[model samples]
Target: MLIALISLFLAGSSGGSAAGSLTAAGVLALVVVFSAAATLAVSFLLSKTLLRGESSAFTLELPPYRVPRIGQVIVRSVLDRTLHVLGRAAAVAAPWGLAVYALANISAGGETLLSWFCSWLDPAARLIGLDGVILAAFVLGLPANELVIPIMLMAYTAGGCLTEISSYAALSEVLSGNGWTAMTAVSVVLFTLMHSPCSTTLLTIKKETGSIGWTAAAAVIPTAAGIGLLAVLNCIFG
Candidate 1:
């Protein structure tokens, strides 16, 4: 699941003009390799420690292939998968949208609520090679990963609403103006790959595990790992 989510991010990041750049492709490929290596290392360590047990072999009977039924396939795909995912996303994103609007618009002590919150996070975020606005965006983006960049843009522009970048050049300009650098970009990419899963994924985890403790772990472990890695990177590069 984590791999799939990371792959989606990589694909989206590479789209448009950036997709044609060899450097961009190489960077994304390296990210994929690192993710795979980290996954394997963690799985091996878990198997030898916390998940230790006698190995067991299991097999499943394969179903015979059948000719495709286009109508039935489309119906099942739309109803069972597409609608289910959209419904879950909407359930989580709706309240988040309102909360984001209020945070960006409401004022306290002559500062917007969102600005105040970002200020509060600034010290810790800087320690990880990220600024307050970037960290705030990630937190606000918990409902959906797709919202992260737009939220950052909104906050950066003081737009008090989600803002879209019309081009990669515009995105680069905004980020540069906000003090982004090579190290900052590296840290952001690492964090994006390792942060807690989205709201829907957390809910699904809770449902499947039937344990709040495990659900919390699912959120915390990856975040902790990301923070630890970012700290190391900052120490080395910042």
Candidate 2:
């Protein structure tokens, strides 16, 4: 949900379907297809090579086919997964959110901490068709995947805290005001897809693997892939 929403928002912000403007659906489609294919390829490669194991023979038992139970599915989705993930996410998001809010709001030398940090990151971020603000949002929003877009909006609008624009037009205006282009939209969508797991997922990975090194690798791998791909694409087309 977070990824889809952020992709859509960036697409629209790049002047999607506006008067005499091209929509970013083309770029979004490309990113989605490529990201999905890359993920599949990596998984296959890992299973076949680094993580290979001898095949085991086993007998399987089958249950009699029955009609699907809608209520049971709903209960399982809510109780078994949704709430559990949400609880963990909330635990990380709360304090992190407060820190983000404070950083964005507190002025330092006539600029907020976030603004200063973004300025410093601008040169590198531009290589990938994104600005420092977007990169900073991803970093600060690490506590929860869902916070990326909101934090971006807050940064772009210079708001004291995260704020949602009432309409797409307003969002487009703010983004355009910050020099957003179709290429920027494409890069953002790709990066969002490739970026590291949110804090909750990182915690889960650590718990499951019991290795900080592996957890760190899991985070770095996708981000590096995203950065390299974005740089190539931006050079070719931006």
Tell me the spans in candidate 1 whose CA falls farther than 4 Å from its real position: 1-20, 54-68
Residues 1-238 of candidate 2 have per-residue lDDT tens digits of: 3234344454454444452143345544666788789998776766787568945357899999999899998999999899988888888888888889788989999999989988998999999889999999889989866677788888887889787776666766787788877577667777888989999889889988899998998899899888999999989997
Index of the highest-TM-score prediction = 1
Which has the greatest lDDT?
A: 1
Worst 10 residues of 1 by lDDT: 1-10
The lDDT of model 1 is: 0.82
With a 3 Å backbone cut-off (N, CA, C), the pairs that clash in candidate 1 are: none
For all candidates in order, the CA lDDT equals 0.82, 0.79
Q: List TM-scores for all candidates, in order.
A: 0.84, 0.76
lDDT of 2: 0.79
Error of 1 at 143 (Å): 1.6
